[model samples]
Target: MTSVQDFATYIAGLPRVLASAAALFRDVEGRVLLVEPNYRDGWALPGGTVESDTGETPRQGARRETAEEIGLDRTLGRLLAVDWIPGTGRPPLVAYLYDGGVLDPGDLAAIRLQETELLSWRLVPREEITDHLPGALGRRVLAALDILTQDTGTAELENGHRVG
Candidate 1:
Protein backbone atom coordinates (compact mmCIF):
# COMPACT_ATOMS: atom_id res chain seq x y z
CA MET A 1 0.00 0.00 0.00
CA THR A 2 1.12 3.55 -0.64
CA SER A 3 2.36 5.45 2.39
CA VAL A 4 0.48 8.51 3.63
CA GLN A 5 3.34 10.81 2.63
CA ASP A 6 3.38 9.34 -0.89
CA PHE A 7 -0.38 9.91 -1.26
CA ALA A 8 -0.04 13.49 -0.10
CA THR A 9 2.79 14.06 -2.54
CA TYR A 10 0.70 12.69 -5.36
CA ILE A 11 -2.10 15.12 -4.61
CA ALA A 12 0.34 18.00 -4.40
CA GLY A 13 1.80 17.16 -7.78
CA LEU A 14 -1.49 17.81 -9.53
CA PRO A 15 -1.69 20.79 -11.82
CA ARG A 16 -3.06 24.05 -10.40
CA VAL A 17 -3.99 27.33 -11.99
CA LEU A 18 -3.42 30.65 -10.27
CA ALA A 19 -6.59 32.75 -10.47
CA SER A 20 -6.85 36.52 -10.46
CA ALA A 21 -9.80 38.93 -10.56
CA ALA A 22 -10.17 42.51 -11.77
CA ALA A 23 -12.86 45.13 -12.29
CA LEU A 24 -13.62 47.44 -15.20
CA PHE A 25 -14.77 50.83 -13.99
CA ARG A 26 -15.73 53.50 -16.47
CA ASP A 27 -16.10 57.27 -16.26
CA VAL A 28 -18.88 59.49 -17.58
CA GLU A 29 -16.91 60.11 -20.74
CA GLY A 30 -16.46 56.31 -21.23
CA ARG A 31 -12.81 56.30 -20.22
CA VAL A 32 -11.55 53.28 -18.32
CA LEU A 33 -10.09 53.59 -14.88
CA LEU A 34 -6.55 52.24 -14.62
CA VAL A 35 -4.30 52.08 -11.62
CA GLU A 36 -0.54 52.34 -11.81
CA PRO A 37 1.07 49.60 -9.76
CA ASN A 38 4.20 50.40 -7.85
CA TYR A 39 5.76 47.08 -8.82
CA ARG A 40 4.85 47.15 -12.52
CA ASP A 41 5.67 49.48 -15.39
CA GLY A 42 2.16 49.62 -16.91
CA TRP A 43 -1.28 50.37 -15.57
CA ALA A 44 -3.93 47.76 -14.68
CA LEU A 45 -7.59 47.45 -13.76
CA PRO A 46 -8.67 47.92 -10.15
CA GLY A 47 -8.53 44.38 -8.84
CA GLY A 48 -6.15 41.71 -7.56
CA THR A 49 -5.44 38.05 -7.01
CA VAL A 50 -8.47 35.99 -6.05
CA GLU A 51 -8.51 34.41 -2.61
CA SER A 52 -9.57 31.00 -3.80
CA ASP A 53 -8.08 29.48 -0.70
CA THR A 54 -10.79 31.31 1.24
CA GLY A 55 -13.53 29.90 -0.98
CA GLU A 56 -14.18 33.28 -2.52
CA THR A 57 -16.02 33.51 -5.83
CA PRO A 58 -14.68 35.60 -8.71
CA ARG A 59 -17.45 38.19 -8.34
CA GLN A 60 -16.88 38.47 -4.62
CA GLY A 61 -13.14 38.63 -5.11
CA ALA A 62 -13.53 41.39 -7.68
CA ARG A 63 -15.63 43.45 -5.29
CA ARG A 64 -13.17 42.89 -2.48
CA GLU A 65 -10.18 43.85 -4.61
CA THR A 66 -11.89 46.96 -5.85
CA ALA A 67 -12.73 48.00 -2.31
CA GLU A 68 -9.21 47.34 -1.13
CA GLU A 69 -7.41 48.95 -4.04
CA ILE A 70 -9.57 52.00 -4.62
CA GLY A 71 -11.35 52.40 -1.29
CA LEU A 72 -14.64 52.33 -3.15
CA ASP A 73 -17.28 49.91 -2.00
CA ARG A 74 -19.51 48.97 -4.91
CA THR A 75 -21.47 45.96 -6.03
CA LEU A 76 -19.92 44.07 -8.94
CA GLY A 77 -22.15 43.17 -11.86
CA ARG A 78 -21.74 40.38 -14.45
CA LEU A 79 -18.58 38.62 -15.54
CA LEU A 80 -17.15 40.68 -18.34
CA ALA A 81 -14.41 38.37 -19.52
CA VAL A 82 -12.38 35.28 -18.67
CA ASP A 83 -8.89 34.61 -20.00
CA TRP A 84 -6.57 31.66 -19.58
CA ILE A 85 -3.03 32.94 -19.85
CA PRO A 86 -0.29 30.55 -20.88
CA GLY A 87 2.70 29.92 -18.64
CA THR A 88 6.04 31.50 -19.33
CA GLY A 89 8.29 29.12 -17.38
CA ARG A 90 5.76 29.55 -14.59
CA PRO A 91 2.37 28.23 -13.62
CA PRO A 92 -0.47 29.31 -15.93
CA LEU A 93 -3.06 31.82 -14.69
CA VAL A 94 -6.82 32.27 -15.05
CA ALA A 95 -7.93 35.87 -14.89
CA TYR A 96 -11.48 37.17 -14.43
CA LEU A 97 -12.82 40.60 -15.22
CA TYR A 98 -16.07 41.91 -13.76
CA ASP A 99 -18.25 44.88 -14.51
CA GLY A 100 -17.74 47.49 -11.79
CA GLY A 101 -20.29 49.90 -13.23
CA VAL A 102 -19.86 53.54 -14.19
CA LEU A 103 -18.52 56.14 -11.81
CA ASP A 104 -19.94 59.63 -11.80
CA PRO A 105 -18.45 62.80 -10.34
CA GLY A 106 -19.28 61.77 -6.80
CA ASP A 107 -17.74 58.35 -7.25
CA LEU A 108 -14.70 59.85 -8.89
CA ALA A 109 -14.09 62.12 -5.91
CA ALA A 110 -14.37 59.17 -3.58
CA ILE A 111 -11.58 57.09 -5.07
CA ARG A 112 -8.64 56.54 -2.73
CA LEU A 113 -5.81 54.54 -4.22
CA GLN A 114 -4.12 51.87 -2.13
CA GLU A 115 -0.96 53.77 -1.31
CA THR A 116 1.34 50.80 -0.85
CA GLU A 117 0.55 48.74 -3.92
CA LEU A 118 -0.57 51.49 -6.30
CA LEU A 119 1.27 54.61 -7.31
CA SER A 120 -1.71 56.49 -8.75
CA TRP A 121 -5.04 56.13 -10.54
CA ARG A 122 -6.19 57.83 -13.69
CA LEU A 123 -8.94 57.71 -16.32
CA VAL A 124 -7.59 56.63 -19.69
CA PRO A 125 -9.49 57.17 -22.90
CA ARG A 126 -10.41 53.92 -24.60
CA GLU A 127 -8.30 54.70 -27.65
CA GLU A 128 -5.14 54.91 -25.54
CA ILE A 129 -5.74 51.66 -23.70
CA THR A 130 -2.82 50.06 -25.50
CA ASP A 131 -0.51 52.81 -24.37
CA HIS A 132 -1.43 52.24 -20.73
CA LEU A 133 -1.62 48.47 -20.55
CA PRO A 134 1.01 46.10 -21.91
CA GLY A 135 0.56 42.85 -23.79
CA ALA A 136 -2.46 40.68 -23.03
CA LEU A 137 -3.97 43.12 -20.58
CA GLY A 138 -4.57 45.64 -23.35
CA ARG A 139 -6.28 43.04 -25.46
CA ARG A 140 -8.27 41.73 -22.52
CA VAL A 141 -9.56 45.20 -21.72
CA LEU A 142 -10.50 45.78 -25.32
CA ALA A 143 -12.43 42.52 -25.43
CA ALA A 144 -14.20 43.51 -22.23
CA LEU A 145 -15.13 46.87 -23.74
CA ASP A 146 -16.63 45.16 -26.74
CA ILE A 147 -18.71 42.90 -24.52
CA LEU A 148 -20.01 45.90 -22.62
CA THR A 149 -21.09 47.50 -25.85
CA GLN A 150 -22.74 44.35 -27.15
CA ASP A 151 -24.66 43.70 -23.92
CA THR A 152 -24.81 40.16 -25.13
CA GLY A 153 -22.48 37.75 -23.30
CA THR A 154 -19.16 37.14 -21.69
CA ALA A 155 -15.93 36.75 -23.68
CA GLU A 156 -13.64 33.76 -23.43
CA LEU A 157 -10.00 34.41 -24.26
CA GLU A 158 -6.70 32.59 -24.35
CA ASN A 159 -3.76 34.81 -23.56
CA GLY A 160 -6.11 37.73 -24.37
CA HIS A 161 -7.13 36.39 -27.76
CA ARG A 162 -10.71 35.25 -28.30
CA VAL A 163 -11.04 31.49 -28.55
CA GLY A 164 -13.86 29.18 -29.56
Candidate 2:
Protein backbone atom coordinates (compact mmCIF):
# COMPACT_ATOMS: atom_id res chain seq x y z
CA MET A 1 0.00 0.00 0.00
CA THR A 2 3.02 2.29 0.34
CA SER A 3 3.69 2.24 -3.44
CA VAL A 4 1.97 4.75 -5.71
CA GLN A 5 0.53 1.95 -7.84
CA ASP A 6 -0.86 0.31 -4.68
CA PHE A 7 -2.54 3.58 -3.68
CA ALA A 8 -3.98 3.95 -7.15
CA THR A 9 -5.36 0.45 -7.08
CA TYR A 10 -6.83 0.98 -3.63
CA ILE A 11 -8.58 4.14 -4.72
CA ALA A 12 -9.92 2.46 -7.82
CA GLY A 13 -11.29 -0.41 -5.80
CA LEU A 14 -13.15 1.83 -3.33
CA PRO A 15 -16.91 1.96 -3.46
CA ARG A 16 -18.24 4.84 -5.59
CA VAL A 17 -21.62 6.44 -6.02
CA LEU A 18 -23.19 7.52 -9.30
CA ALA A 19 -23.50 11.23 -9.91
CA SER A 20 -25.62 13.37 -12.23
CA ALA A 21 -26.04 17.07 -12.92
CA ALA A 22 -28.96 19.06 -14.28
CA ALA A 23 -29.85 22.64 -15.10
CA LEU A 24 -33.04 24.36 -13.96
CA PHE A 25 -33.98 26.50 -16.89
CA ARG A 26 -36.73 29.06 -16.79
CA ASP A 27 -38.58 31.16 -19.33
CA VAL A 28 -39.12 34.89 -18.98
CA GLU A 29 -42.55 34.13 -17.53
CA GLY A 30 -40.85 32.11 -14.81
CA ARG A 31 -41.96 28.78 -16.15
CA VAL A 32 -39.46 26.00 -15.62
CA LEU A 33 -38.21 24.22 -18.68
CA LEU A 34 -38.36 20.44 -18.72
CA VAL A 35 -37.30 17.85 -21.24
CA GLU A 36 -38.77 14.47 -22.03
CA PRO A 37 -36.11 11.83 -22.43
CA ASN A 38 -36.63 9.05 -24.89
CA TYR A 39 -35.02 6.63 -22.48
CA ARG A 40 -37.17 7.52 -19.48
CA ASP A 41 -40.82 7.66 -18.54
CA GLY A 42 -41.25 11.07 -16.89
CA TRP A 43 -39.91 14.47 -17.92
CA ALA A 44 -36.62 15.79 -16.55
CA LEU A 45 -34.36 18.82 -16.47
CA PRO A 46 -31.68 19.16 -19.14
CA GLY A 47 -28.85 17.18 -17.58
CA GLY A 48 -27.25 13.79 -17.27
CA THR A 49 -24.52 11.73 -15.62
CA VAL A 50 -21.26 13.43 -14.72
CA GLU A 51 -18.24 11.99 -16.52
CA SER A 52 -16.13 11.72 -13.38
CA ASP A 53 -13.86 9.21 -15.05
CA THR A 54 -13.05 11.92 -17.57
CA GLY A 55 -12.48 14.51 -14.83
CA GLU A 56 -15.72 16.35 -15.49
CA THR A 57 -17.12 18.20 -12.48
CA PRO A 58 -20.82 18.36 -11.71
CA ARG A 59 -21.04 21.93 -12.96
CA GLN A 60 -19.31 21.03 -16.19
CA GLY A 61 -21.53 18.01 -16.54
CA ALA A 62 -24.65 20.17 -16.14
CA ARG A 63 -23.52 22.58 -18.81
CA ARG A 64 -22.52 19.74 -21.10
CA GLU A 65 -25.78 17.93 -20.59
CA THR A 66 -27.75 21.11 -21.25
CA ALA A 67 -25.88 21.65 -24.49
CA GLU A 68 -26.14 18.04 -25.59
CA GLU A 69 -29.79 17.65 -24.65
CA ILE A 70 -31.19 21.03 -25.64
CA GLY A 71 -28.53 22.66 -27.84
CA LEU A 72 -28.00 25.67 -25.61
CA ASP A 73 -24.38 26.29 -24.64
CA ARG A 74 -24.77 29.25 -22.33
CA THR A 75 -22.93 29.30 -19.04
CA LEU A 76 -24.93 28.04 -16.08
CA GLY A 77 -25.76 30.08 -12.98
CA ARG A 78 -24.99 29.26 -9.34
CA LEU A 79 -25.70 25.84 -7.94
CA LEU A 80 -29.28 25.62 -6.74
CA ALA A 81 -29.53 22.27 -5.05
CA VAL A 82 -27.78 18.96 -4.32
CA ASP A 83 -29.62 15.76 -3.56
CA TRP A 84 -28.36 12.38 -2.41
CA ILE A 85 -30.68 9.63 -3.52
CA PRO A 86 -30.46 6.13 -2.15
CA GLY A 87 -30.32 3.50 -4.83
CA THR A 88 -32.86 0.72 -5.15
CA GLY A 89 -30.61 -2.07 -6.38
CA ARG A 90 -27.52 -0.19 -7.48
CA PRO A 91 -25.07 2.36 -6.16
CA PRO A 92 -26.34 5.46 -4.41
CA LEU A 93 -26.59 8.63 -6.48
CA VAL A 94 -25.59 12.23 -5.95
CA ALA A 95 -27.56 14.65 -8.13
CA TYR A 96 -26.47 18.21 -8.69
CA LEU A 97 -28.91 20.92 -9.78
CA TYR A 98 -27.79 24.23 -11.22
CA ASP A 99 -29.53 27.43 -12.14
CA GLY A 100 -29.99 27.82 -15.88
CA GLY A 101 -31.46 31.31 -15.48
CA VAL A 102 -34.42 32.81 -17.29
CA LEU A 103 -34.37 32.32 -21.04
CA ASP A 104 -35.46 35.08 -23.34
CA PRO A 105 -37.84 34.46 -26.22
CA GLY A 106 -34.98 34.24 -28.68
CA ASP A 107 -33.23 31.74 -26.48
CA LEU A 108 -36.38 29.72 -26.25
CA ALA A 109 -36.81 29.83 -30.00
CA ALA A 110 -33.25 28.67 -30.48
CA ILE A 111 -33.79 25.43 -28.56
CA ARG A 112 -32.90 22.36 -30.59
CA LEU A 113 -33.78 19.07 -28.97
CA GLN A 114 -31.38 16.18 -29.37
CA GLU A 115 -33.48 13.74 -31.32
CA THR A 116 -31.49 10.72 -30.30
CA GLU A 117 -32.07 11.29 -26.59
CA LEU A 118 -34.77 13.86 -26.01
CA LEU A 119 -38.30 13.46 -27.22
CA SER A 120 -39.38 17.07 -26.68
CA TRP A 121 -39.06 20.13 -24.45
CA ARG A 122 -41.57 22.41 -22.77
CA LEU A 123 -41.94 25.13 -20.17
CA VAL A 124 -43.99 24.24 -17.12
CA PRO A 125 -45.11 26.56 -14.42
CA ARG A 126 -44.06 25.89 -10.83
CA GLU A 127 -47.43 24.47 -9.87
CA GLU A 128 -47.34 21.93 -12.66
CA ILE A 129 -43.76 20.81 -12.24
CA THR A 130 -44.84 17.83 -10.20
CA ASP A 131 -47.09 16.69 -13.02
CA HIS A 132 -44.09 16.47 -15.29
CA LEU A 133 -41.22 15.53 -13.01
CA PRO A 134 -43.03 13.59 -10.25
CA GLY A 135 -41.46 11.73 -7.31
CA ALA A 136 -38.28 12.88 -5.64
CA LEU A 137 -37.10 14.49 -8.87
CA GLY A 138 -40.05 16.89 -8.85
CA ARG A 139 -39.40 17.73 -5.22
CA ARG A 140 -35.73 18.35 -5.98
CA VAL A 141 -36.57 20.79 -8.74
CA LEU A 142 -39.03 22.52 -6.47
CA ALA A 143 -36.35 22.96 -3.82
CA ALA A 144 -34.07 24.57 -6.39
CA LEU A 145 -36.85 26.92 -7.42
CA ASP A 146 -37.47 27.83 -3.80
CA ILE A 147 -33.87 28.95 -3.56
CA LEU A 148 -34.42 31.27 -6.51
CA THR A 149 -37.73 32.61 -5.27
CA GLN A 150 -36.43 33.22 -1.77
CA ASP A 151 -32.94 34.37 -2.76
CA THR A 152 -31.64 31.88 -0.23
CA GLY A 153 -28.38 30.06 -0.68
CA THR A 154 -28.03 26.54 -2.03
CA ALA A 155 -30.12 23.70 -0.63
CA GLU A 156 -28.92 20.33 0.59
CA LEU A 157 -31.32 17.46 0.19
CA GLU A 158 -31.68 13.77 0.77
CA ASN A 159 -34.02 12.00 -1.59
CA GLY A 160 -35.40 15.43 -2.54
CA HIS A 161 -36.30 16.34 1.05
CA ARG A 162 -34.51 19.41 2.32
CA VAL A 163 -32.01 18.45 5.01
CA GLY A 164 -30.16 21.64 5.92
Candidate 3:
Protein backbone atom coordinates (compact mmCIF):
# COMPACT_ATOMS: atom_id res chain seq x y z
CA MET A 1 0.00 0.00 0.00
CA THR A 2 1.12 3.56 -0.74
CA SER A 3 1.87 5.43 2.43
CA VAL A 4 0.30 8.86 3.13
CA GLN A 5 3.77 10.41 3.20
CA ASP A 6 4.53 9.07 -0.29
CA PHE A 7 1.27 10.52 -1.64
CA ALA A 8 2.02 13.89 -0.07
CA THR A 9 5.51 13.83 -1.54
CA TYR A 10 4.18 13.06 -5.03
CA ILE A 11 1.66 15.87 -4.87
CA ALA A 12 4.21 18.40 -3.70
CA GLY A 13 6.53 17.49 -6.55
CA LEU A 14 3.90 17.96 -9.23
CA PRO A 15 4.14 21.14 -11.30
CA ARG A 16 1.24 23.58 -11.24
CA VAL A 17 0.49 27.01 -12.57
CA LEU A 18 -0.19 29.92 -10.28
CA ALA A 19 -3.70 31.23 -9.73
CA SER A 20 -4.56 34.79 -8.70
CA ALA A 21 -7.76 36.64 -7.81
CA ALA A 22 -8.58 40.34 -7.93
CA ALA A 23 -11.52 42.60 -7.15
CA LEU A 24 -12.65 45.16 -9.72
CA PHE A 25 -14.00 48.02 -7.70
CA ARG A 26 -15.31 51.24 -9.12
CA ASP A 27 -16.57 54.59 -7.88
CA VAL A 28 -20.03 56.10 -8.23
CA GLU A 29 -18.90 58.06 -11.28
CA GLY A 30 -17.62 54.87 -12.97
CA ARG A 31 -13.88 54.75 -12.35
CA VAL A 32 -11.77 51.68 -11.79
CA LEU A 33 -9.88 51.00 -8.55
CA LEU A 34 -6.15 50.50 -9.01
CA VAL A 35 -3.50 50.05 -6.40
CA GLU A 36 0.14 51.07 -6.71
CA PRO A 37 2.27 48.10 -5.83
CA ASN A 38 5.65 48.78 -4.30
CA TYR A 39 7.32 46.19 -6.49
CA ARG A 40 5.93 47.40 -9.80
CA ASP A 41 6.23 50.76 -11.52
CA GLY A 42 2.60 50.67 -12.69
CA TRP A 43 -0.67 50.25 -10.81
CA ALA A 44 -2.79 47.08 -10.69
CA LEU A 45 -6.12 45.90 -9.40
CA PRO A 46 -6.22 44.87 -5.75
CA GLY A 47 -5.32 41.17 -5.71
CA GLY A 48 -2.72 38.48 -5.11
CA THR A 49 -1.82 34.86 -5.74
CA VAL A 50 -4.04 32.13 -4.36
CA GLU A 51 -2.75 29.94 -1.56
CA SER A 52 -2.57 26.46 -3.05
CA ASP A 53 -3.84 23.33 -1.32
CA THR A 54 -5.48 25.49 1.32
CA GLY A 55 -9.06 24.56 0.40
CA GLU A 56 -9.77 28.22 -0.45
CA THR A 57 -11.84 28.97 -3.53
CA PRO A 58 -11.10 31.73 -6.06
CA ARG A 59 -13.98 33.89 -4.80
CA GLN A 60 -12.72 33.72 -1.25
CA GLY A 61 -9.25 34.61 -2.41
CA ALA A 62 -10.58 37.65 -4.25
CA ARG A 63 -12.39 39.02 -1.19
CA ARG A 64 -9.39 38.33 1.03
CA GLU A 65 -6.99 40.02 -1.37
CA THR A 66 -9.19 43.10 -1.61
CA ALA A 67 -9.38 43.42 2.16
CA GLU A 68 -5.68 42.79 2.57
CA GLU A 69 -4.58 45.22 -0.11
CA ILE A 70 -7.16 48.02 0.31
CA GLY A 71 -8.51 47.47 3.84
CA LEU A 72 -12.05 47.22 2.48
CA ASP A 73 -14.43 44.58 3.82
CA ARG A 74 -17.11 44.98 1.19
CA THR A 75 -18.59 41.94 -0.49
CA LEU A 76 -17.43 41.06 -4.00
CA GLY A 77 -20.55 41.13 -6.13
CA ARG A 78 -19.96 38.79 -9.11
CA LEU A 79 -17.53 37.02 -11.36
CA LEU A 80 -16.91 39.65 -13.97
CA ALA A 81 -14.12 37.92 -15.86
CA VAL A 82 -11.67 35.04 -15.92
CA ASP A 83 -8.39 35.10 -17.84
CA TRP A 84 -5.74 32.50 -18.57
CA ILE A 85 -2.38 34.19 -19.06
CA PRO A 86 1.12 32.92 -19.62
CA GLY A 87 4.20 34.09 -17.79
CA THR A 88 7.76 34.76 -18.87
CA GLY A 89 9.97 32.47 -16.76
CA ARG A 90 7.31 31.10 -14.47
CA PRO A 91 4.33 28.87 -15.00
CA PRO A 92 1.16 30.14 -16.70
CA LEU A 93 -1.52 31.65 -14.49
CA VAL A 94 -5.29 31.80 -14.17
CA ALA A 95 -6.65 35.14 -13.01
CA TYR A 96 -10.09 35.86 -11.61
CA LEU A 97 -11.69 39.31 -11.59
CA TYR A 98 -14.63 39.81 -9.24
CA ASP A 99 -17.10 42.67 -9.18
CA GLY A 100 -16.22 44.77 -6.14
CA GLY A 101 -19.24 47.06 -6.54
CA VAL A 102 -19.47 50.84 -6.88
CA LEU A 103 -18.25 52.78 -3.93
CA ASP A 104 -19.71 55.95 -2.44
CA PRO A 105 -17.82 58.82 -0.84
CA GLY A 106 -17.88 57.10 2.51
CA ASP A 107 -16.63 53.84 1.02
CA LEU A 108 -13.89 55.61 -0.88
CA ALA A 109 -12.72 57.41 2.21
CA ALA A 110 -12.45 54.15 4.09
CA ILE A 111 -9.82 52.69 1.72
CA ARG A 112 -6.46 52.23 3.42
CA LEU A 113 -3.64 50.87 1.32
CA GLN A 114 -1.45 48.14 2.67
CA GLU A 115 1.76 49.95 3.50
CA THR A 116 4.15 47.06 2.91
CA GLU A 117 3.41 45.72 -0.59
CA LEU A 118 1.24 48.65 -1.74
CA LEU A 119 2.40 52.22 -1.98
CA SER A 120 -0.99 53.86 -2.57
CA TRP A 121 -4.47 53.46 -4.10
CA ARG A 122 -6.62 55.60 -6.35
CA LEU A 123 -9.64 55.62 -8.66
CA VAL A 124 -8.81 55.88 -12.34
CA PRO A 125 -11.39 56.90 -14.89
CA ARG A 126 -12.47 54.07 -17.16
CA GLU A 127 -10.81 55.66 -20.16
CA GLU A 128 -7.51 56.22 -18.33
CA ILE A 129 -6.94 52.68 -17.08
CA THR A 130 -4.29 52.09 -19.73
CA ASP A 131 -2.14 54.88 -18.29
CA HIS A 132 -1.88 52.96 -15.04
CA LEU A 133 -2.06 49.21 -15.67
CA PRO A 134 0.21 47.40 -18.10
CA GLY A 135 -0.85 46.08 -21.50
CA ALA A 136 -2.72 42.82 -20.94
CA LEU A 137 -4.01 43.85 -17.52
CA GLY A 138 -5.25 47.16 -18.85
CA ARG A 139 -7.12 45.32 -21.54
CA ARG A 140 -8.44 42.91 -18.95
CA VAL A 141 -9.83 45.75 -16.86
CA LEU A 142 -11.48 47.33 -19.86
CA ALA A 143 -13.06 44.04 -20.90
CA ALA A 144 -14.28 43.43 -17.36
CA LEU A 145 -15.90 46.86 -17.27
CA ASP A 146 -17.64 46.14 -20.54
CA ILE A 147 -19.01 42.89 -19.14
CA LEU A 148 -20.10 44.71 -15.99
CA THR A 149 -22.14 47.29 -17.94
CA GLN A 150 -24.25 44.97 -20.11
CA ASP A 151 -25.56 43.26 -16.94
CA THR A 152 -24.58 40.04 -18.67
CA GLY A 153 -23.41 37.04 -16.75
CA THR A 154 -19.62 36.83 -17.11
CA ALA A 155 -16.74 36.86 -19.56
CA GLU A 156 -14.38 33.99 -20.19
CA LEU A 157 -11.08 35.08 -21.67
CA GLU A 158 -7.57 34.03 -22.53
CA ASN A 159 -4.94 36.65 -22.01
CA GLY A 160 -7.73 39.23 -21.53
CA HIS A 161 -9.60 38.56 -24.77
CA ARG A 162 -12.78 36.60 -25.41
CA VAL A 163 -12.02 32.95 -26.14
CA GLY A 164 -15.48 31.88 -27.37
Q: Which model scores highest in TM-score?
A: 2
Error of 1 at 13 (Å): 1.7
User: Which residue pairs of candidate 1 clash?
Assistant: none
Model 1 residue runs over 4 Å out of place are 1-7
1 or 3, greater by TM-score: 1
Per-residue C-alpha lDDT of model 3 across residues 23-134, encoded as one tens digit per residue: 9988999998889999968889998888767987888898888899889977788898889898889989999999999999999899988899998888899878988886
Which lDDT values do the candidates have, in the order given?
Answer: 0.92, 0.94, 0.88
| Reference-based TM-score of each model | 0.93, 0.96, 0.91
| Model 2, span 66-119: residue lDDT tens | 999999998999999999999999999999999999999999999999999999
TM-score of 1: 0.93
Between 1 and 2, whose lDDT is larger?
2
The residue ranges of model 2 lying beyond 4 angstroms of the native Cα positions read none
List runs of model 3 lying over 4 Å from the truth. 1-14
Candidate maximizing lDDT? 2
Which is the winner by TM-score between candidate 2 and candidate 3? 2
Question: Which 10-residue window of candidate 2 scores lowest in summed lDDT?
Answer: 35-44
